[model samples]
Target: MEIGLVGKPNVGKSTFFSAATRLEVEMASYPFTTIDANKGVGYIRNRCPHQDLEVECEPNNAPCINGTRMIPVKIIDVAGLVPEAHKGKGLGNQFLDDLRQASTLIHIVDASGSTNSEGEPCGKGEHDPRADVEFLTKEIDHWLKGILERNWDKVSRKLEVVGGNVEHAVYEQLSGLGVSEAMVVLAVRSADIQESPKNWSGDDLYRLAKAIRMKAKPMLISANKADLAGDDLMDSLMTLGDDIVIPTSAEYELALRKASESDIVEYMPGEDNFKVLRDDISDMQKSALDKIESHMKRYGGLGVQQTLEKAIYELLDMIVVYPVENEHSYTDKDGRILPDAHLLPRGSTAEDLAYAVHTDIGKGFIRAIDSRTDRVIGRDHELKDGDVIKIVSK
Candidate 1:
């Protein structure tokens, strides 16, 4: 699954991306610093099952760091969005298109209110960060509504004549956005639009579109630049009901990672503290590290990693499963122990895992074996998190 990093320009969205993925991108203090989308591989942390099974892991797909499995997930840093983006203003079309494949979005807001509606630099607290959250949602909602409204009269008439399924028809319009028919059905149910598509009003379509966006592209808020924010701003963002807002300092996180890369500090992503490895560091560097530590102490570590974890594990409801060729040894064909880690949605079955592994393997339609229990499980058997299973295909 891919996660899209979206925000108004100059809010450190690129910084967040660099911090999370350790990939460099152009960053500046002005709007539209990122014109094209930057795609990189980020990771979701999971406990390595090798630890429980007491075996050395020779991981292939995901790396093991200190008994933690870092499963790779694609992250897209799209161009910054502005108000009325759906109306084709300020790289709006580019941003929307870039996010079509995103399973979820991380809205990075300038919690310090240092960026204005146009994403231009402003005095701290000059703009209401809450407006940033609300506007982005509305922009996406309107964009979806626009797509649904196109050729509505003709499409609805055809559907009415054929007595077609509204949910399926809507899904066809939004499938490009990675929206499933099941999600469309749920959105329709939530919308409660009683009228047939042919007679549905604009408001009805818009409500349905909003519901669909909510399901299809659920978002988590990264209240960035937290070091420059006040308690009032942070509290206000936190109280935005139903939105998961995490205080983050993308600048500080990037700094720490850069330090780690240079071996100046011993640090890991998601760690609450870091060790300064060198004592002969310049006073300027020491001062910067001291401030970051204080900030970490105040807000419980840099929220970049925490926000990614929440987006994948919480919003996406995903679990990591180990697929091995040998259930007994948790090894693959090359004899690499615990070779691969796959992230599947909660309640995914053994069959789904087979398909995830390979289409031919799934088509063979055989049973699977649970390595932990040494129990033979049918294709439909539900797999749990950290499951090490070997498919017995023909």
Candidate 2:
């Protein structure tokens, strides 16, 4: 699944992207630093079977090799969203368009409330992160509304004939947004549409838009610049409810990674402390590096990893499944079972997995053997995490 990182400019979105993917991008403390979307593969680090087996292994059922351990998930960093984005303000249409392809959204907010409504640095502004959060959601909803409005005559006319099946009409309108047919079905079934379009209240429209938005709803707020946010900001953000708000210092993590690569300091991104590897570096520089490293480890990669994973699993309700032929020796397309992990949406059945492998296997119906338990099950069997399935097909 693909996830998009979105927020107002200079809220550390690029920094988060760079830290997560370890790819370099231009990051600045100003608006519109990223004019276009940047795409990269972010790997979810997990132990693979070959690593666990500690031997050269191969799988007869699926493609894999020896000692492969991690799988990659795509991440797209879109341009910043501004007020009136739905109305075509500040590259608004462009920003929203960039997100059309993403399955989930990670709304990265400046927890410290250091920026104004337009994403400008406000040294003395109140830390009301809720405004940014709520505003961004509304913008997206209205953006979709605008699309519907443009096609209202055709969509509304169709809805009149279909009656209660207005959901289908709505789905047709949203098909361009990259929403799948299954997702549209779910959204329609879950939405509450009125019998008469004119009778629909403002709240009714809002709810319909919300249902569509929830199909690609965002999760987790990366409370960036946490070290600078302090207790007042933390308490204020806690009041926003039980949403996973992870405190992070993207800037600090980026600095630490750069310093480590440059050999200026011996520090890791997720480690709390660092040993002074360079004796030639000044004491002030060492002190500065130590503080940043402390922030990185304490906040844990500035919540980049947690936020990305949380958004994928919680917002999108996805899971990681490993399809392998040999539980003892797993492998991939290249015959290397280097970390056997594939993130898929929950409720994925065996047939779905066969499709993931190849259409030929899925088309030719057959039984599957669960390597972990050696239990044979039909094609409809739902897969669990780390499942090694041997598809006995034609």
Candidate 3:
């Protein structure tokens, strides 16, 4: 699954991306510093199952770092969103299109309220972060709505005469956005607009649009630049949703990672604290590290990790499974132990994992063995998180 970093300009989306992926991108104080989307492999931290089995795991594709499985995922840093972007302003269409494949969005909000509506520098608390959250959601809705509306006449007219489903028509319109027909159907049903396709009003279309956007592009607000934010600013943002707001200091995360690279500090990607390896650091650098430490102590690790975890596991309901040829040794054909850990939907079955491993194995149509229990199981057996399965193909 892909997670897209989105927000107004200068809200540190690039910094967040750099910290999370360590991909060097141009970060500037002005708007639209990222003209195109930058994609890199980020990771989700999972407790490696090898620790429970009392064995040392030598993973190949997904590495285990100190008992934490680093499962790689695609992360995107996209161009900032401006008002009326759906109206083709400020490379808006390009930015929105960059998010076409994203499973979820991390809205990098300037929690300190430092940037204005146009992404220009402003007072620390002048901008309402609540507005920042809503504006991005609305912009995405507008973008989807525009796509649906542009083809409405042809689609609705065809649906009327051909007796085609409204959801399918809308889904086809938004096919480029990776929207599913089931998602569109649910969105239309949730909006409670029972009108026929040809009779759908602009408001009806918008309601459907909003619902589709909510389902297809669900977002979590990464309360970014939290170092400069006050209590009131945080409280107001918390009021938006208890679990949705993750206070993040992208700048601090970047600093910690950079320090780790420089051998001045020993750090883990998602650890709450770090070890200062050397005492020769300058006083200014020491002060900055202190502030970052304070942020970590308060918020529980750099929020970048938590944000990605939430997007994949919580929002997307994905679970990790180890598909090995030899379940006993947890090795692939080449004898690489725990070589592949595939992320599948929570309810995915053993056969689903077989398909994820190889199409030929899935088509062979055979049972699977659960390594944990060493029990023979059918294709329909639902796989759980950290399940190690050996497919018995024909």
lDDT of each: 0.90, 0.68, 0.84
Where does the lowest 10-residue lDDT sum fall in candidate 2? 23-32
Badly placed stretches (over 4 Å) of model 1 are: 23-37
Q: Which portions of model 3 show Cα errors greater than 4 Å?
A: 23-37, 241-243
Per-residue lDDT tens digits of candidate 2, residues 250-304?
A: 7776776677677776653334566667789878877887687666665555566
**Model 3 shows how many backbone clashes?**
0
Cα lDDT of model 3 by residue, 126-201, tens digit: 9998898878888998878778889898888988788866777788888878788888889988999877778888
Top candidate when judged by TM-score against the true structure:
1
Residue-wise C-alpha lDDT for candidate 1, range 309-377, written one tens digit per residue: 999999999999999999888899999899789999999999999999999999996899999999999
- Ranked by TM-score from best down, the candidates are 1, 3, 2
Give, for candidate 3, the lowest lDDT window spanning 10 residues: 23-32
How many times do residue backbones clash in model 1?
A: 0
Give me candidate 2's TM-score against the actual structure.
0.84
Q: Is candidate 2 or candidate 3 better by lDDT?
A: 3
Tell me the TM-score of model 1.
0.95
TM-score of each: 0.95, 0.84, 0.94
The total of clashing pairs for model 2 equals 19
